[model samples]
Target: MARWQPKLGLVQETLLLTLHARALDAKLPSPILGDTLSAELAGAIDYDFGRLKVKPSLVATTALRARKLDDVVRAFVAVHPECVVLDLGCGLDPRMFRCDPPPNVGWYDIDFPEVVKLRSEHLPSRSHLIGADLTESGLLDDIPGDRPAVIIAEGLLPFMPGDSFRRMTRELAGHFPSGELALNGYTRFAAWAMKYHPTIKALGIKAAQGFDDPREPESWGAGLELVEEQFLTRAPEVALFPQPLRALTRLTARSTGLSRQGARILRYRF
Candidate 1:
């Protein structure tokens, strides 16, 4: 059988890290997200997973963050049954499968052309997969603008340039009638630290932008209001982690400052 080789750029290549993290988490005795599809997708690829040397804590953090995002999506979809869901920079991650929105909801996964092609060939999704770069103008025009929509940017924001990030947020806000934007956010310090992270450094990727305040996006001309800021280190899902990891998370959970330096999920309503 031929291995699934995806032609993705440097930034797009980072998707494999999250994919591997979810895959590793699924192998755990008590997995946080339990995404078997991610595991299968990771295995199907011919890339060298050993190069990443992904840590168990990183795996736990990835799963916990993903689970939180899934919860947010589920909650929104529960209320707005006819909403349009746009998974921006949607890589090979099977988030649509995990969320399983009602038939009334229109699900769309947007990514680079090659990545979308890879997804179509390997993953079975009911989502309308679009092949386009989010940074390009008129990208939002392809999506339904009249309906209420939920825009998810999981591991995407950090890699996007500051100007591009701001423009994208504002554009999304103006594109949809009303909805929410959910994403894993990084503080300036966290973004700097990412350069030294083993998996990140190995992939030769660096965060293009970061923010110290969760509410900072409100100034991006998006009319975005911070709905919630969920710090993963202090989340209940930490309890599901292995012994030392769980204890360490509990220790850091005591300080809001300390937890902010780690992974956080930010939700905004536009």
Candidate 2:
């Protein structure tokens, strides 16, 4: 197979990281992210992201985060059957199929125009796909505000600067009268380190901003409240990790400082 060089949009570029991580996860004796679609996508693209060297711990972290986001979307839709679910920066993730929103539930997967074009050719037509840059406001206008809403940004926050993140929050919160927002949170140091991380650097991606405290999002609006902060390493799923790695996570989970140093699935209500 010829090596396929990806000319993906920013959202698509970032989302493909999960697919790569999923591929790495498959190599594990025990795995976290088992999205067969992700594997298929990688194969279809003939992706050759040479020797990124992802640590099992990192792969486990990715899997755990994806799983939790899946759970949050599921729970949110369950309560509000008529809710509008907007997946911001949704690049080729089969979350709609996984969550299976009811017919009444409106699902919109928004990313760059080109990514949406490619996604239209590959992904099943269930939810509506919008091609727009999320950094700009007004795109949310197309989504209905009458129903309860759920906004999810899986692995996107760290890529934006603090001001931009705040603007995004304000725009999203302003769009829906009441809704749930969920994302993977990163510490300031982790955000800075991500830019220099061998894997991220090799992918030609840069870290724009990060917050040390999860509560920082609250400042975006008084309506936003911190509902939960999920520590993936301590989840029951960690027990499913491969040998040696499972034991290592156990130790990391026991230490409060060490666990917070890792990725977080942050849930908020507005």
Candidate 3:
């Protein structure tokens, strides 16, 4: 059994941090995401997990975020059985396996070449792997435009850098005939705080993008409409969080302002 060692740059390396968080959650008595695939990948990767300093709260939030995104995928695929699913900045998350869409559905995972190479080394080739910077023009051209597309960004937003996020959204909205774009969003403060978040700080990650208003993207002129905003604090899954954190979440869940300071998922119709 050979362990696959990774050599990703700073931004790309954050994938492991997120991956390890889900792996940690899967080990719990009653996990939120129950992503055993991530757990197996974490064990096989020859990286120092301790250095990421992944805490229980991060694990809980990461899994919950993934669970929420998975729900979005399931719902979309149910409505549009012949739709396409795009998991951008996919890393080695095994979302295609988790979603397990019908044979008629097409799933594609996009990431940097290094990460995609690493994914091939560890996971089976289920989805089409596209290794190109999302900001590049004509990236989505290769994907079919005939079907509805469910685009998921996960933790890939802040890493988009500068105004690239704006351009990316417009491209996605125009590329798909119809569908939704879903991702874990950060408020202005939440995005700024990532600089010092324990796990993020440990990896020296600094995110530059954030929007306090979920509706702000609607103003991006991207032909996107706000479908729903799911703050993690108010999520039904928050009840599963550990001890003091769970109680604290219940307290803050009442306020969208406080909730936005934490984990929140945004979905939009195009």
Candidate 4:
């Protein structure tokens, strides 16, 4: 059998990094996300994950952040079983499967045409996959606006320019009557560090935008109100880390300023 080789652009190819991170976590005895599907999908591909040199901390952080997002989605769907879920720039991640929203929920995974094609071929999903550039107009027209919606932008925001990001948030907010928007946020300092980080540099990906304040998005006219900001370092999952890493995370968790420098999951109600 031939290994699947990914033909993706630099930005799109960065999905492999998160995939690798999840795969690594799946191997742990007490995994944070326990996404063995990521490991299976990763193994089927021919790409060389060795070159990324994905560290343990990276894997733990990725899984922890994903789990945090999953918790938010699960909680939302529990209350609004008939909601609509739009996973913007979803890439190949099987978030719908992880969240397992009720049968009444409508799940849509949106991404570039090429990536959507790849997802259709590799990942098993019940989601309605839409192939389109998120930055373009009329992309949101296909999504139903009658129900409450949950818009999740996992790794999509940083790649978007500031103006585009603002416009997207506002458009999405306006599309739904009321719902939650969850995303992994990067502070300006974290964005800078991402550029120089060995793994990120290897992928030739740089974050196009970052924010110092979680509440800044509210000013974008999205009618978005900051609900909560979850710092991964402070999450209970950190206890699953190795001894040294766990201690370091606990120490950093003590300071809001220091924890903000790492990964954060931000939730907003619109």
What are the per-residue Cα lDDT tens digits for candidate 3 across 1-270?
A: 578788989888899998999999999998999999899989988999999888888999999999999999999999999999999999889999899999999898999888888887789888888898987767886799889999999998878888888898898788889999999998878888889887778878766588888899999988999999998898899889999989988999988788888999999999
lDDT of 2: 0.79
Candidate 2: where is the Cα deviation over 4 Å? 1-5, 9-12, 24-30
- CA-only RMSD, every prediction: 1.3, 2.3, 1.0, 1.2
Q: What clash count does candidate 1 reach?
A: 0
Best by lDDT: 3
Angstrom error at residue 15, model 4? 0.6
Q: Quick one: ranking by TM-score, best first?
A: 3, 4, 1, 2
lDDT (Cα) of model 4: 0.88
Per-prediction TM-score to the true structure, in the order listed: 0.97, 0.91, 0.98, 0.97
lDDT of 4 by residue, 1-270 (tens): 347999999888878999999999998899999998888889899998988878889999989888888888888998899999888888888888888887899999998899999999999869999998877778877788999998889988878865887888888888889999999998988877788888888888766568889999889899999999988888878889988999999999999999988889999999
Runs with alpha carbons beyond 4 Å of true place in candidate 1: none
lDDT of each: 0.88, 0.79, 0.90, 0.88
- The prediction achieving the highest TM-score against the true structure is 3
| Tens digits of lDDT, candidate 2, 60-143 | 888788888989988988899999998887877878887888899999998878788867887778999999877777787678
Between prediction 2 and prediction 3, the one with superior lDDT is 3
Error of 4 at 189 (Å): 1.1
**Per-model tally of clashing residue pairs:** 0, 0, 0, 0
